[model samples]
Target: MGDPGGTDYAVSAEFYDLLQAEPDRRRAERWFAGAAGRARHGIVDFGAGTGIVTRVLLESSGVPVHAVEPAPAMRTVLMSRAAAFGADRRARLTVHPGRAEDAGLEAVADLAVAANVVGCVEPAARRALWRAAARALVPGGVLLFDPPPVGLPDGIEALEGLGPVRMGADSYLADVTRVPDRGVLRMVFDYRVERAGLAVRGAREEFPVWPAEPAVLVAEAAQAGLELVAAPHPDLLAARRPHG
Candidate 1:
């Protein structure tokens, strides 16, 4: 959601889901299932883009969920999805119109999850984002997320690739380029959408991501009162607030 001077989600939002592979959804579902077991009251989906993870948490846990998203276009889609839910699910869902770094949320949730979002946060704002998550949780509450891989793949110089995907009548092509340097990956996502054999939409979103070492994140989180905990999944990192 936090575009940060990059192309907005006006066009990209339409093809966002297409970018998510089955494995990505399954990973999120598994993480949510584990976190939901420990949650007592509510949960927060920090960057609830299009409510993908938010919907999973709502249906899986049937608990109150705060979906914090920033981009207007993406939020529009999320709100629409939330509106279509049954009364029971709707009653348990809240969509916040802000980024994770400063969502101004008041509810102290039992669990907080940020999926594929930490890497997109600006370096200077990462601490604030983590601290905000720490402050939003009740004592002993957990935060689960998967940051980008710590380093570039072996022998991969400035990763770049393009792929084509289709959703119903729309066809889309996504071009991804990443240049890793100084612990940061400067990534760009360029998309082109076509309908009826004609290119109709396009978007280019660019941002810098800091892939902090696991140990570094643990230390930083400790400063914010969150103790790093061993995660069940190898790709995920979990932290917990100290119990009173």
Candidate 2:
């Protein structure tokens, strides 16, 4: 939840399920379903915004889940949904309030999944986030996430500057701040968006953010001591921590 509206989560959260489309959702669903088969103890949803994926993990595995979100607004939604899953019982879900960089998940879970999170910080912050995720895992645990592919067309970056991207009555656009480094570009895109059919418009800004290339993500995970289990793609990426 770490400030999806104001953060990288953005209007993507508002129309998240919609824009994610069925195929993409199924892909992620399948990925977690597979992960559930491998994870024996517990799982941590790194960004856990709204708990969409968190619920998926719980339903798929019924293992312990820690839904960590930094954004109060998103966390509220997550807690509400957690109740639906009987998460209030100590046996099920645990909610943690913090950003990925400081989530302190180490030895707390058998696996950690970042989903679409982790790409919303500066390069240093992004690396730190990955390190934190790796630390949160037990040996042989996994970290899974898919950030937007790097090398965005120059036009896309240009379009980003032309106010917010308007779809229906909502605007998914925000001002961007970028710091370029070799192949990596650290950036933050703040979005003020409204739901397509809903009457309420929620506004917020995301900061301390950025995106990275798929290869860079893998290397960073490796640097964090996670073996690349799935390389980032338009589809998915999965990585594992080897058991000693």
RMSD of 2: 5.9
Q: lDDT by residue for model 2 over 31-68, one digit each (tens)?
A: 67677656788888877877778777777775788877
Q: Would you estimate the TM-scores of all the predictions?
A: 0.84, 0.69
- Candidate 1 stretches with Cα past 4 Å from truth are 1-7, 21-23, 152-163, 167-170, 181-183, 194-202
lDDT of 1 by residue, 145-199 (tens): 8875666544324444444677788887877777666667777777888898898
**Cα deviation in Å at residue 180, candidate 1?**
3.2
Residue 36, model 1: lDDT of 73
Off by over 4 Å in 2: 1-27, 87-90, 157-209, 230-234
lDDT of 1: 0.74
Total clashes in model 2, counting residue pairs 3 or more apart in sequence or in different chains: 14
